[model samples]
Structures are given as C-alpha cells and as structure tokens.
Target: MNQIVLTTLNARYIHAAFGLRYIFANLAELQAQTVVREFTIHETALNIAEKILAEQPKIVGISVYIWNVSEVTELVGVLKQISPELVIVLGGPEVSHPPDLPAVCELADYVVTGAGEKSFYDLCTQLLQRQTPLNRMIEGVSVPLPQLASPYQYYDAEDIQNRICYVEASRGCPFKCEFCLSALDKTAKPFELGAFLDEMDNLYQKGARNFKFIDRTFNLKVKTSVAILEFFLARMDDELYLHFEVIPDNLPDDLKEVLKRFPDNRLQFEIGVQTFDPEIQELISRRQDNQKTIENLRWLREHTGAHLHTDLIFGLPGDTLENFAESFDQLVALNPQEIQLGILKRLRGAPINRHTDEYQLRYNPVPPYNILSTRDISFSDMQRVNRFARYWDMIGNSGRFKITLPTILGDRPFERFLTLSDALFNASGSTWKIALKRLFELVYEVMVGTLLVDSEQSQTVLREDFLRSELKGRLAFEETKPLTKQKVGKGIANKRQKMHQ
Candidate 1:
C-alpha cells in the first residue's frame, strides 16, 4: 500500500497534471512510498475521497486550481471527516495567493503555495518519517531551473500513449501584464538546453507525439528557440504536433526563418495580443509595440504554415465599445486561423484589481470572475459583446463559412457582425444549442431575409462554404455533390472534427 498519494481533480482526464508529477519525481528517498492519482471534476467529491482512501495513503497532496476549487473543497472536507489522521496538502495557483485563499484551505492540514516541487518533497519526507511537520501554510521557494529534477521521466505509459503531454522548456514571464497571474514573476528563466532536449528525445522515443510547451516566452532566446525548432524539424512527421505561446512582437528574422520551416498544422502559435489600444496598454503596464506585433502576425499568416490562434480581451479599464470594435475588425483582417475573444477576468492576486475603483469594474465574484461591467462598457453592452464572441466562434472561427463570412460581415466587420449578433440573440433568445444546419439557416435568413443581400447569390455562397466543412447535410439552398468524393486535407478535416467535438 502506498503511504503517500499525490492526487488532484483535473479539469479533464486528457489533461495530465504536470504539477503533481513534478512533486512525485522530486520525492528523492520517499519516491517508492509515493504515487500520483488524477481524477476529473465530473467525479463526485465523495467518490474521489473514497478512491484516495482505498489506497490507504497516510499523506495525500491535492493540487488545486480555480476550475476544480469547489469540488476539491468538498473532497477535502470528506477526507477530513472519514480519515482524521490523513495529512492533506494543498498546492497550485488556487492556494498560492494569500488574500484570496478559498474556504478549502481551512480543512487542509497543510497548504504549499507557489512553486511546490522541492517544498512538497521536503514536506512529504517529514510527514512520512513520523516527524511533526512545521507550519500550516508553507511558502514554496522557487527552485532554479538547472537544480530542479525534470518531471518528464515520470509520465507513465498511458500518458505517453493517450494524453497531451505538457513539456515546459522554461518557467516564469518577463513582462508584467497586470491582468495575468504571471505578472507576479520577476523574470523568465530557461532550463539548460542540452538537458531539456535530451528529456524531449526520450519522450519522442517512447511514442509521445503530441507535445504542448507551457513556456510563457518560447521564442525569447533566439538561438535556444532555433535549437528546439531544429530538434523537432529533424523528426517531423504527420503525427508530430507542437504548440507554443510566443511573444508576438519578438519574432526576429532568425526565429521567423525557423518557424517557417514547420509544416501545415504541425506548429500552433498562441500569440497574446490582449489589446491593440496604446493608452490601455500603458495603463496596464503591458509594453507591446503594436506595429511590430501586427507586422509579425501578418508575416506568420502569409509566410508560415503555422496555425495562428490570437487572443483579444474585452472590458479593459479605458476601453470603449468603439475602440474594441476597431481592434476586432483589425484582428479579423489579419486572418488568423482562430481569434479567441475573451472577457477580462479579475484574477485573485492580479494587479488589475487596482483599476477596479477607477474603472468602476464590477465582477461576478465567482470562479473565473469575469468583468460584468466597466466604466466605458455598461452591463447591457457587455452582454451583447458576450453574444457577439460566441456567435463569431460559431461563424468565423469554426472555419465552416470561409467564403461567406466576409459577406455576412460587410465593410465594417465588427459593426456588421454586432448587428448580426443582435439579430441572432433577439431571434433565438440564446446563443448555444444552435446546430450546424440551424446555424446555416439562421445565417441565410439574416443575410437574405433581413440584411437584403441578393437571395440567390447568398444561398450559393453559403451552400459552398457549408459543403467544405460538413460531411453529411442537405442545405436549404441547393443540392450539391456528395462530400465523399471531395479531397479535403487530412489536417484540416481533423482540426474541424476536433473543434466540433
């Protein structure tokens, strides 16, 4: 029986918890007595507690996050009630900030805040050795990159075969964007390149193909980025997919040349252009050269085969509806593979809280704590934009209506789409539960019946776009050739399928 069990309720089973694995790998002498167990938020807290108790673990560590805090809170309560002697340790982002500790911490025997790899190992050693552990809450010391043990070697067979294995070549962020939790970090730090690559080589040899890097700035160091890219380039195949969150404005010529070498759909870049407004950027201490960022984005779209997923945040302090629309239209014009329109969230320890009074920012006071209203944007306007974001995801980002999307969103893409968003909300009273065929019909009705576009032309364009993505469906417009004969690229088809699922 395992005397120590490291467990956490992950948002999903497919997401392998990297934090727990870090602690497990660094357990040193206590490694043999320890085990890691992962469960999803869907499981009942009682059931999760029961499963952990079944292992008869004397010391249990639970990694907590905003998404799983409620369930984890209940699970911790149940564990305390059933097994009074069980030493419960809580770690991760949810418990890292002091002023915003959730109610779950009171039930926990110990809470390890911040980077818990080394601290967690030390705590486990003390508890497992029948020694009294110090303090109820311990602040984790940030272990140096080269000094800490790598967590990749502990990824089990099932993780390598099925899950999206997360590999971080670095930790921390250098830029302090007030809205982000990473803003608290002093500076970005990279792991030793040779050692990190060796770990990656081992994972690749073990049949792990899908790798998602958790580095905040993957392309910061140009030469290091090139080496990592070259490593994957030599082993490039159909199944090899790598994802990175890169600094949009920092893509130099060397990095751009290396990035262009990756095949279509093999590399995905999540560039965070949170806002295009210069005034707001200054207020948030987000130093982004808009021109350079836009230029890099254009080059990435035009020159590289990489799928671009760009982000935009609404409801910033000084952001007006008019300014946000300009940003939206600009992003649409860039023609990224996907645009993630996110509402500003007031994170627990984020410095963005400082702007709350000045901006009249009101949040839901719940998990995710999305901005309900700001000084410039009213509650009703925020609701409309929320619907606009969802509808855009359905029509624009789905890649279903390629040719017809521009037709639907006329000269002023944002204003036109906002009008359509209003029409959609007024008609359905809800944004979700809209099926593919129904959505097609809605678009046809809006464009033809309301917007007064030529009915015949609209129908033909919509039908073509519909046929491009869907395999089986009869359009309201016309009869088309069966998709069975169409030769769509394997990568594009797979992406669409995954998105819909």
Candidate 2:
C-alpha cells in the first residue's frame, strides 16, 4: 500500500499531470512509499474519494488548478468526512497565492505555494518521521536545475505509449502581462540544455512521440529553440507531433530557418495574440509588435506547414467591443489553422485584480472566474461575444468550412459572424447541444436565407463544404448524399480541378 498518494483531477485523461509527476519524482528516499493517481473532472467527487481511500494512503497530496478546483473542493470535503485522520495536502496554481480561499484551505492540513518539488518531499519526510510540520502554509523554493530530479523518468509504459507527455526545458515568463499569473515570476529560468535534451532523447527512445512543451516563452532564446527543434527533426516520423507556445513576434531568422525544416503535421505552434489593440496592450503591460506578429503569422501560413493555433481574449481593461471586433477581423485575415477565442478569466493572484475598481471588472466568484462584465463591455455584450466564440469554433476554426467560410464572413468577418451568432442563439436559445447537421442548417438558413446571399452559389458552396467535412451523419439539405469513398475522391478531384482552373 502506498503511504503517500499524489492525485489530481485533470480536465481530461489524455493530459498527464506534469506537476504531480514532478512531486512524485522528487520524493527521493520516499519514492517507494509514494504513488500517483489521476482522474478526470467528469468523475464524481465521491468516486474519487472512494478510490483514494481504497489506497489507504497516509497522506494525500492533490495538485489543484482553476479548471478542477470546484470538483477538487468537493472531493476534499468528502475525503475529510470519510477519514478525519488523513493528512490532506494541496499545491498548484489555484492554491498557490495570497488570500487563500477559506472554502478550499480550511479542509487541507497543509498548502504548498509555488515550486512544490522540494517542499512536498520535505513535508512527506517530516510526516513519515512523526515530526509535526512547523507550518500549515509552506512557501516552496525553486530548486536548482541540476539538483532537481527529472520528472520524465517516472513516466510509465502506458503514459509513453498513449498520453501526450508534457516536457518543459524552462519555467516562468519575463513579460508582466497583468491578466496572467506568470507575470509574478521574477524571470524565466532554463534547465541545463544538455541534461534536458538527454532526458528528451530518453523519452523519445522509450516511444513517446507526442511532446507538448509547457514553457511560457519557448522561443525566447533562439539557440535553445533551434537545438530542441533539431533534436526532434532528426527523429521525425509519421506519428511525431510537437506542440509549443511561442512568442508571436519574436521569430528570429535563425528560428525561421529551423521552423521551415519541420514537416507538415509534425509541429504545432500556439501563438497567443491576446489583443492587437495598442491601448489594451499598454493597459495590461503586454508588449507585442502587432505588425511583426501579423507578418510572422502570414509567413508561417504561406511558407511553413506548422499547424498554427492562435489565441484571442475577448475582455480586457481598456478593450471596447468595437476594437475587439477590429482585432478579430485582423486575426481572421491571417487564417491560422485554429483561432482559440477565449473570454478573459481573472486568475488568483493575477494583477488584473488591480483594475477591478477602475474598470468595474466583475467576475464569477468561482473556479475559472470568467469576467462577467467590464466597464467597456456590458453583461449583454459579454453574452453575445461568448456565443460568437462558440459559433466561430464550430464553423470557422473547425477547418470544415473551407470554401464557404469567407462567403459567410464576407468583408467584416467579426460583424458577419456576430450576426450569425446572435441569430443562432436566438433560434436555439442555447450555445451547446448543436448537432453537425443542425449547425450546417443554421448557417445556411442564417447566411443564405436571412442575410440574402446568392441562393444558387451559396447552396453549391455549402454542399461542397458539407461533403468535404466527411461527416458520418445526414446532411442539412435533401440533395446531398452520404459521402462514399468514391464520392469523396471525386469531390476532392473536382475541387482540385477548379483550383487549377
């Protein structure tokens, strides 16, 4: 039986909790007595409690985050009720801040704030030795790169085989973007490149093909970026996929040369262009050269085969709905593979709270404290934008509506999409539970019928887009047939022939 169990409810099963593994790996002499257990937030709190209790762990340490905080709170309460003697420990971004929410901390025996590896190890050592730990709140110290044990060695057979193994060569962010918790970090720290690469090489040899780097500023150093790219480039295969969150406008010529070498479907870059509005950027202390960012995006789309996933946040202190629309239209023009349209969230300890009174920023007082309304954007506007984000994901970002997307968006992509968004929401009264067929129908009806697009051309375009999707379900229109292999091939050929013409 494990004496210490490191557990957390991930948003999904595919996401292996890197933080928990770090704590597990650093247990040192206590490694044999420890185990790591992960569950999805979908699992009921009672169920998670039952499973943890079954292990009969002397201490249960949970890695908390904004996404799983609500479920974890419930699970913690249940665990305390079932085994009052159980030593409950909490760590991670959610609990690692000032003004600890009483709802979560009251039940916990201890809370470790910030870099948890050494702190967790010490706490476990003291508990196992029957020595009363001095404090309930432990401020974690950053362990030196060489001194800290690599979490990668703890990856099991199943993890390497199936899960998207997260590896980080660095931690922290240099930019002080007010909306983000990373702003509090003094500076970015890199692990020794040689040692970090050796760990990556080992992981690769063990059949871990999907590597998602969690570094905030992955492309900050060109040499380090190139080395990491070359390491994976030499070992490229059909199954190989590497994801990194890059500095949008910081693409040096050296970085560009290496980036172009990566094959299609192998590299995916997540660029956070939170806003293009200079006023909003200034307000949030977000330093972004909009021209450079746009140029980089266009070059990546034209020259490189990297799947670009760009981000845009809806609400910020100085942002108005009009300016946000302008930013949206700008992003849409770049035509990235995916546009992650997110509403601003007030994370714990984020300096965004400083603008609460000034901007009249109100947020939901719960996990994922999403901005309800700001001085510039009203509650109604927020709801409208929320619907727009959802619809944009379904129609625009899904990459399903290739030919018809421009037609649907017209000249003003944001305005057009917002119109459709409002229409769809008004008709259905719900953003979710929309089937593919119904969504297609809604788009056709709203864009073609109500908006008065050329009916014949719109129908043809919609039919081609629908067939291109290769959806298993029935089509929105009666004339469309099920996509057979032969039909799909013919449709693709016809589209290719038209493109050549």
Candidate 3:
C-alpha cells in the first residue's frame, strides 16, 4: 500500500492555527494509506518527528503558518536527515500567498499554491508513476480543473463540541486592503449553500456545538451568506454556536433581522474595521465609511442577540500614536463584546509592499513583521503600540479582564489598561504570561481600592476555575467573561451609568 503522512500543529491549541481537514478529506481518494498527525512546536517537535519516521511513509506533507513555520521548517530538516529520500510537499495560507516565499523554494521540495486538494492528489500520482520532481505540478491556479475538490469537513460531533470547527463556504476576498494578502487575491467564489448545509449537518450530528467560518468576507455575498444563516437559524436550538467575519459597513437589514432570531450568545461576528481615520484608510487602500460602520454596529446591537467582536489595526501608514488612540477610543465607544487590537502584518503577497518607499515604512524583522513607524508615527510610539497589542490580547480579549477589573470605567477609559500594561512590561522586561499575571493582579487591586465592588475574591476565584474547566481550549472566550459576582454587579452599574450619562 502506498503510504503518505500529513502532519502539523493542532488548530484548537493555537488560536491562529487554521484547520487542514479540507486538504486531508479531499485527498482521501488518492488510493494511498494516509496518516494525519497534530502537535504543537512548543509541545514536542522531536517526538512527533520520531513517530512519523516510524510510519515510514512514501510522501510527507506538512502545512505551514506564521506561528508554526519555524518549527515545521526545523522538523522537516530533521526528518530529511533521517529518511533522506522522502518527498516533502508544503502548502497552506502562508505558502499560498507569498510574493517570494523562501521556505517554499528552499525547504520543501514542492510548494503547491492556491487550493491543494487536486494539486496534492495529482502530485502524489505522478510521483508514484516515476516522475522524479513535481516542479511543473502547480495545480489550481496554473491549470483550471473542474474536478478539483474543496477540502473541508466537519469533525465528529462529540469531538467537535470540545474543539472549534473551522469551515469555509467561499474562497478569495473581494477587498483591496493593501496590508492584507487576501485583498490581492480578490474574487470571493462562493460554494453551493445546500452542499455546505449538508456538510454542516454532518458536523452538527457528529457533536459540534461551535463553528467558525473561515471565509475572508462572509457578508460580501448577501444571498449566499443569508442562505447559510437561515439554514443555521432553522437548526439552532441553543446547542450550536457560529462565528463569522463580517464587513461592518456592508451589513444588510435582512441579515440583521435573521440574526435577531438567534440567542445573543449563540452567534458572533468579528468585524475588521482596521482604522476609522479616513486618511489612514485611504493610505492602506481600505475603503470604509467610518460613520456607516458605527451606525451598522449600533443597528446590530439593537436588533440581534449575536455577540460582537470588532478589530482595529495599529501602525498603518500615515497613522501616528495619537491617531491610533483616537481610532481606538471611537471603536471602544461602540461597546463591542470583544476588541481585537492587531498590529500590521507585512505579508509577502500584500500590495502594501510595493508602496514601502511611498509610505517610508520600516517594519520589524520578527514573525509578525509589524511596522516600526513612519513620518506620521514615531519609533517610540510603535514600541508603545506593540505593548498595547500584547495587553489587549491578554486582558481585553482573553476574557479574564472583565472578571477582575471594575467596569466602573467606561470603554474608552478601560483602554488605559493597554497603556498601563505597556509601561509596566517595558519596565520589567517580562514574558507575556508573567505580564498577564501582573496585569490581572493590578486590575484586581484597582477594583478593590476604588471600591468598584465589595469583598468577593473567594467567589470570583471559584468562578474563574469553573470557566477555565468549561472552556479549556477557548482561552480567549473564557478569559473575556465576567468572573465574579462583584464584577457582574459592577458591569450592571456601569451600563446604567452609560445610559444615564
């Protein structure tokens, strides 16, 4: 039997890791023995290497991403040293959308671009048939094959309940946000809704309670997006939860009505605003109506029970620290369920790379490749923003902030935590875990000192433990919840203050 091995880091363990089920399921018909293995680079790379070596597969395929690329590269180097003759194929979002990706050309023998379902199968067949190198085997983009199956599958319902199942109803993004790779690859080809619904049903039956749509812009197509929503609406019985990425300004009245039918906690939408500064938006080629976005957000809050997660990007071209702060304050005023503060990622295929000189942008040399600062923003300000990103991830989105921090502070003022944590971590030179612990401690102290709540630390600790247990893999979701009765009381008080003020 022909044997093929596919391995990578698990998506559930890391929030940034996207699912590879579609690739595995589509290539299932290649008439070969296949094994899929998952492990964290931080967990055990060498042990995973040993296990895969023991299998002695003919071909080894590994999915690469920004977070795990270094680990995967190192693992591949070790794997090749041991086996010497294994055919290594690399593919995924990271490799697919690079202008001149070094890892693909030097590390992996073959790099499959775009959708790998058909390309992977074709390459496997050719290799088995005595083709030495599959260099000319770039599928999907180069050759238009109708038979190319989309690789996506829902996991066992019971297994999926504990994990986040990522599904994609479409491919490609329709925007030209210069800083984003998806913007360059705009098209937004949607799949059949009935077929997608059937796939979802299979997953639902298997025990999935949480689903995240990986589509670039789910709301770009009203009819298709609405159909999927309606299908889920018909089946939603409080047991299932779905998450989507939506364009805030493009939200339709009809979809808002559909969302209203579902329980507030059952559905969530992550809207990427990037920036509210019109000049900054124009610089990045991101077309957005600042006023419309705010109005649409208010409409969703009033009409739908769905949880709202809004995003803001720091360090865009022509944006200073003051501009970013102002944009952040405005977004916070909207009172989203979650505020994801992201720094700019200078991706390879992104159009913004072409305008580096025009913008006079200098980015970091690390994994994230964030902008250092430009004429509009200073280097010191960018460093401060870096700290802001770290704290926001931990306290704002991590779900632990609401539990300890007094909600007496308005959304805009609560953001002071980001600046505070930035200053503290810079002084201590501490790791994120250590920084997070300190931030939580300080937040508690502030709450108690300010009389935000009465003595209820003991009750809050138990509640936190419960949340940690209930949502083991979903740290972001778990940490964002109000942990104590005191905190909950403070939240109510703060809401009343907002209304009255």
| Candidate 1's TM-score | 0.95
Indicate whether candidate 1 or candidate 3 has the larger lDDT: 1
Q: What is the lDDT of residue 380 in candidate 3?
A: 81
Question: What is the per-residue lDDT of model 2 for residues 283-396, given as tens digits with 9 covering 90 to 100?
Answer: 889999999999999999988878788999988998888999999899989988778999999888899789999999999888688988998899999999989998888777
> Which lDDT tens digits does candidate 1 get at residues 235-261?
987789898999989988888888888
- Cα displacement (angstroms), candidate 2, residue 179, comes to 0.8
Instruction: Give the poorly placed runs of model 2, Cα more than 4 Å off.
Output: 100-102, 472-476, 480-501
> What TM-score would each prediction reach against the true structure?
0.95, 0.95, 0.82
Instruction: State the displacement of the C-alpha of residue 359, model 3, in Å, after optimal TM-score superposition.
Output: 2.6
Tell me how far the alpha carbon of residue 231 in candidate 2 is from the true structure, in angstroms, after superposition: 0.9
Q: Report lDDT (CA) for all predictions.
A: 0.86, 0.86, 0.67
* Quality of model 2 by C-alpha lDDT: 0.86
